[model samples]
Target: MKYVLGHKNPDTDSIISAIAMADFLGDGYMPARSGDLNKESLFVLNEFGIESPELPELNEVEGFVLVDHNQEAQMFDGLDKSKIEMIVDHHNLGGLALLSPIFIRIEPTGCTATIIYKLYKEAAREIPENIKKLLLASILSDTLNFSSPTGTEADKMVANEIARETSIKIDEFAAKMFKAKSDLTGMPISRVVSADYKEFEMGKFNVGIGVFETVDPAPALERKGEIVEAVRELQQEAGVDYIFFAVVDIVVDMAYLIMPTDKEKEVATAIFKGDLEDDVLKIPGVVSRKKQMVPSLQKYLENV
Candidate 1:
């Protein structure tokens, strides 16, 4: 049987899309998440009586599919590329789409579930009611209920159709789901980060970090100083490469990417067509790292 799985740091959209793909492929496939599913996603899966399959060791797997995210740097430790049969995702391409023997499906939609829903229709597969509900919920959660800059007309349309089929009121369900996700009082900064981190290879640099701004960049900025200090203290952390953090403002379509690299700053200045201001790039129309930043950055790296 062929299996499809998501990257580490699985989100609602990734989890739900994997489930939907499993349903679409039926007997020939199973769906999995690479890491421990987030609480939000876990709630959805359990609530719907769906259990996401465990991520199989990549060496033992003969066939695989990719969904939601497509970054080799963020894939599970043992997932070998030779086994993948397809890559279906909504995130901006990161060179993995060109890998041989993998049928690539990428669309610039708000959530990957939106794309998966289309596949469901194209394959003439009937999505279960609860699965449809989860898909709609995933879109709402990932797109910040259509407030994110990445949200598209198609996203809203699919979400509406899915909501109707699932019999869930969009506004009320979105409100409840968003509320459940926004409670992050006692969690450590590291966990909050690992819950949404992405790693990328930029030219000769191996950069990895998370992006989000809850209170203010000021808190994260202060913490960055401490984190840098700690990194200096312990020079042998496993995943410690060039770390770049971003304070993303969805409303402004800009993010202050905080990093301690001259090369990254130089590249950002070139991409923005202007000099960076105090290590901050005023990137207009940039929102999600998956959707906005990574593609351009990857192209920039390829050129360099």
Candidate 2:
């Protein structure tokens, strides 16, 4: 049997793409997750009534297909040792190198689901209504409802097509989905910070960034001290050189970054050139970590 999975710390796109692809492949293919589901992913699955994929026991599988991410760091442990049968992803290739030739489909589209939709078209296979809903939700979540800089026209077109098939109003469903993911009212500060966390190795620094997108950033910002402390604890526990926690206001397209240390604060000020207020820096029109934050921080880390 062939196993399909997404990156560790699986987000909505990763989780949904894996499930959709496995369903499309049929026969021997089985869907799986590399890590625990985040709050947003859980919300999406629950909203759609999709069962979460089983977590794989071994890090190395004989035959496997990866989706949503291509980096070894973001994959399960021992992926490099596994026989990679195929890769369908959207992110820039990182340190995943395979010795043997494999079927690879990496695209510049915003979401892997967009690429998968094209594959279904190429195969002349009809997408089921449930799969269409999953694809649409993944695209909306990854592209931040077409507002993210990483989003492309391809993503929008595919989303419209899926919406038409699924009979889901894009605006209404997206608003409901985003609102469901944003209600962090009673969540602990640690869970709030780790909700959508991702780690990157930049130069000599092990950098960790956590993003929390909401309709309003006030509720999270209201607990600034506790959140900052949680970030500090995460930094220490993870042994990361720098940690950044951002509370993004999806409605206003603004972000408030929380930097726990003086070094992190300095880096944020240097990169954003925004004034720090109470250890939080206000950055307007900064929504995407992949398109905006990661590239800028990687360049800064490389030079400094």
Candidate 3:
């Protein structure tokens, strides 16, 4: 079977969408994850008695289906173009060129699973109970339980319908999922800094950004020195000139941004204009990195 996977540093939405798409495509497609699962994804899979997709070695895989992301930067490095048979994403085009005429579906939805849900409806196929729960989980995650700016009416509508059908309370389940996401008890500083990292091509610069969202910020905030070092190492490893990791407070609408070195701090301050407090920038009312941070940074860089 060919593997269907999402971008690297897979979030709950990325991983869940892969599972849903694989099921939607029927036999010959198995859901896969490009990176290790974060706490939230693990909790959802375990909660629903779903086994994690077997990690496929990219070089050995015959062909693959792309879901949740289409950017080459977000995928395996030096990928063979002919290996891609399909592409489905919710983000902007990233100049992905394929050899053959492949199936491509890109939408401006909150989550790729939201698109997958619509696909089911359009095909007149009844979504299974497990897929419904998984889709609801993914939509809630990517939309921050309908609080994120990325959350659209369709996302909220789909989530509500599944919540009612599966008899799952949205608020309660979201709280539990966020709680599980925040329990980064024993993770190393490196993993904490890169839980949800994504690289964006901003003008002439490749900027790597990671957001760690949690109900309580203490777990990440308490490790400032280590986070600093980790960010430095991670940026170097990613071969990016800039890397910013944000410890987002999900309860309140705030985020504490961390950038390595004085140079990075200066660049970030100029870009975000946030208040620097105790080596971390206090970005008030900024939680969704995709909606609030990346587009702004990309625009700024485009003009520079």
Candidate 4:
């Protein structure tokens, strides 16, 4: 049996794309995740009566149809490293194995779910009402409901189609989804960081951690200290050679990269092709990891 899955930090796009792929593969395939679904995603699943498959034992299985996330750490507990036959992701691509996939689909689009939605359309497959709801929710979550730098015209089109099929008032559903996500008051900083952690290796010299935050103003300012401390703690615990987190201000188009080491600053300076100001780097009008960050960093690493 084939297992379609994604990273442990299973975001909406990852979750929805895996399910959609399973739909395409029919009954012989299983849709799975590396860990627990976030509260917001869980709420959507419950509303649609879509039960998450039991967390799969990362053991022997047919080749994996990886989606949304490609980090090796997201695999099943004991699955062979070579068994990941396919990979589909939209995040910063680093640390990928030399011969990891037989079919790799990496796009610069905002959401992997959008890509899956396109595949369904191309194949002339009717997206089930429940699955459409999930895909629409994934687009809204990842794009911050059309208010994110990651959003694109294609994303908007897919979202509209899914909402129409699901009979959901898009605006109303998105408002509720954001409200649920922004209710981050009591959650620990560690949990918040883990909610969206992506680890990247920069050559053999540095490792970075990137986390996305969608909150603004008061809440974001309130959480900054906690986030900085949490990043420090994670650096030690994860034992990465170096760690950094870029807090992207969606409206301002500037990034405040928080790091515990100067090596991170050095790498950022080289990658962004900008000087470090006050020892804090800035990437003006910079957004989109796939389109901007990863490509720049890869070149910088290669040169170094």
**Local distance difference test values of all predictions, in order:** 0.69, 0.86, 0.87, 0.71
Give the 10-residue window scoring lowest on summed lDDT in candidate 1.
Answer: 229-238
Expressed as tens digits, the lDDT of each residue in 65-167 for candidate 4 is: 8888776655545767687777777776656674532888777778988888888888899888788888888898788677667888999998887776667
lDDT of 1 by residue, 123-202 (tens): 78787788788888888878877767678999999988887776788888766664445445566655655666667776
Off by over 4 Å in 3: none
User: Listing every candidate in turn, what is its Cα RMSD in Å to the true structure after a full C-alpha superposition?
Assistant: 3.9, 1.7, 1.4, 3.4
Candidate 2 lDDT by residue in tens digits, 1-304: 5778898778889998999899888988889998777767787788788899988756435578899887766777666445678899998777676788888899999999999999999999998878888899999999889888889999999999888877899999888888877888678889889878888888888899999988878888999999999999989987889999999888888889999989998898889956589789999999888888888999999789
Give the winner by TM-score: 1 or 3.
Answer: 3
Q: Highest lDDT: which candidate? A: 3
Query: Model 4: number of clashes?
Result: 2
Q: Which ten-residue region of model 4 has the weakest summed lDDT? A: 212-221
Q: For candidate 3, write residues 1-304 as lDDT tens digits.
A: 5888898989998898899999999988889888889999999999998998867776677788899988889985555668889988888887777777999998888999999999999999999899899999999898888777888998989988898899999999999999999997889989998889999998898999999999899867888899989989998888997788899997887889987877667777887867997569998888988888888888887787
In model 3, what are the clashing residue pairs, if there are any? none
TM-score of 2: 0.94
